[model samples]
Target: MTNQLVPTSGSPERGIIVPVPHQRPEHFDAETQERLNRVDDAAFEAIAEGRPENTVTAYGQDWAAWEKFCAETSVPVLGVTPGTLVWFVEWLWEQPGKKAGTYTAPSTIARRVTGVTVSARVDHKVKLEEGVARPARARLTQLKNELAKTRETRGRGKAPALKIPHLQLISAALPDNLRGIRDRALMLIHFSIAGREHELAWLRNRHITRTDEGLVVDVAVSKNHPRIVGIPYGTRLATCPVRNWDAWKTAVEELTGEPVDPDEFAFRRIHAKGKSLMAGGITPEAVGDVITRCGEIAGLDIRLTGHSPRRGFATEAVKKGKEREAKRQGGWSKTSRAFEEYVEEAGIFEENALHGIGL
Candidate 1:
């Protein structure tokens, strides 16, 4: 049947049809509309508040993941509940790939979960202020509860600490030639200084100063604080610089095959096959790989990494400090967590026992 255009009750019957007024789409409910606007506002506010790019990127990725999950599950944003969040966490946990598609370490997962919970709580607060009825609780508390449940479902895994012998073995395994010497020196410096890999990588030749008394390393940047570390005249390492600075000077010169410039890296790149040196500094990954190779050479059946030297240094220094002025030479900050770790490793009573026993 052909459709006829009938006149409305308010219009004259001249067969003149009037256009219908446009209505907003029904897909966006009042709550959903509010949430969509809030999301846009929050994003703008986040940027305006000067949030770091990395942090903003992480949040964007996380929220995008949430939206994807919701769309797949046919869940509405305004209908999100704590139970929905729990399910989302489970979905994330069960995802295929390393660490269940999260690509995050355990500590990283913990941190990210905390962030998600915080975002949810913030959204919940916005809803509540808009007359949505719900009791408010801290996001941390919610995260802790969810984490406990998740852990209960998925059994905890153990992570092993790096071993010192493994590190020594790695060092021993490197070709005992020029590269070997450089690797050994690098390892020794890493352990002796207990420095971060980046700090070591960025270390310049001028940072190391030799005087009539001793050698001192001026650490321009550090985790806790910037400070100078000195090797006094009497120590074994000190003699190379204090008693005869030329020994270190000559060793460095021989390694580099040129007069070492003050602006050059303390450890310059040397070609494995030849004596030719490169101007650029070594990366942390290269340093770690070299250490791993050293472990293999030493015939040690354990894993090792660049960080081993720093941990080993802290362990050894704590042990050596028991009888002598233990705290003085390490150059550790009074408030540093390393101090606590060192003390824990070097038991106070065990240190006092030698003093108690008469020779």
Candidate 2:
């Protein structure tokens, strides 16, 4: 009546297996059990094994897109050829993204290729021989070159770099209420540390320690790794993260009618009608909502997300001529090639040659 299979375990080289959610029941003859086991294993492996939920979701989306494209084009999804990959890249280049009539970014196309490659080899057991992979690589190289040219002729994507004045305006514009206090605290803490959305949402009172200088926040888990970051006391009361946190924390304690539990989530949803708190931690999406709402109130018409604060921190720091400080604060690893992109994006205008001109 039951056929259960667990991932083989031994060495770290063997990947961790997370159970697939909402697994469907299959009624089959006992004779076919062995044959279907491998198939089921392959299906599960197609998913991101041992990966974070967000990563799994992204990979799933990439795979789904690839699958859809293959079906539509009458191309073999499994054992996909280099020619097919080249075609896929071209197809990606032609597709519209968020904006009307605008093509997708080259970076996005590159990730889709990576996702398809991994899924084909690891999950589908398709052989990606050097002969096949080489041409595909060459085609991708051509695609990159073409995209670079297009970027030079047109411009980069639509992520607007937020500034300090925008932050000040948004903060000042917020209504004087419990939600406002929470949002102000969230923004200050998020911007100061230059941490990711999940990092801010997952924070706990236990992870924060009072210090002589200001506050030491222990980011227990982040996109990179865990680290203890310092938030220095602000000379200005208007923009002080420590002060905002104290006010928010006091309000939270009062609403809960108990001392704030160190282990509990620092940020939670405040009920709209009353002063009651939600029972769970806030999501990363909620962080984006806060940014969007604040941005609207500040009279900006740009699409903002949770990444705004981190990106804003980098851009603002570079504008202030503190490139090294920005990298360190944002937890951007020195070894990562993506560091260059961050620098380029942040410092492109600030460090331009025209700055030195008398005109």
lDDT of each: 0.56, 0.75
lDDT of 2 by residue, 22-122 (tens): 53435566657767778867765855475555555556777887888888898877847788887887777777776565667776777787778777766
* Global fold similarity of model 2 (TM-score): 0.71
What candidate 2 gets wrong by more than 4 Å, as runs, is 1-50, 121-127, 130-141, 144-158, 270-276, 301-304, 319-321, 335-358
Q: Candidate 1 has which clashing residue pairs, if any?
A: 169-295, 170-294, 170-295, 171-294, 173-297, 173-298
TM-score, model 1 to reference:
0.51
User: What residue runs in model 1 are displaced by over 4 Å at the alpha carbon?
Assistant: 1-103, 109-176, 232-252, 255-257, 272-274, 322-335, 348-359
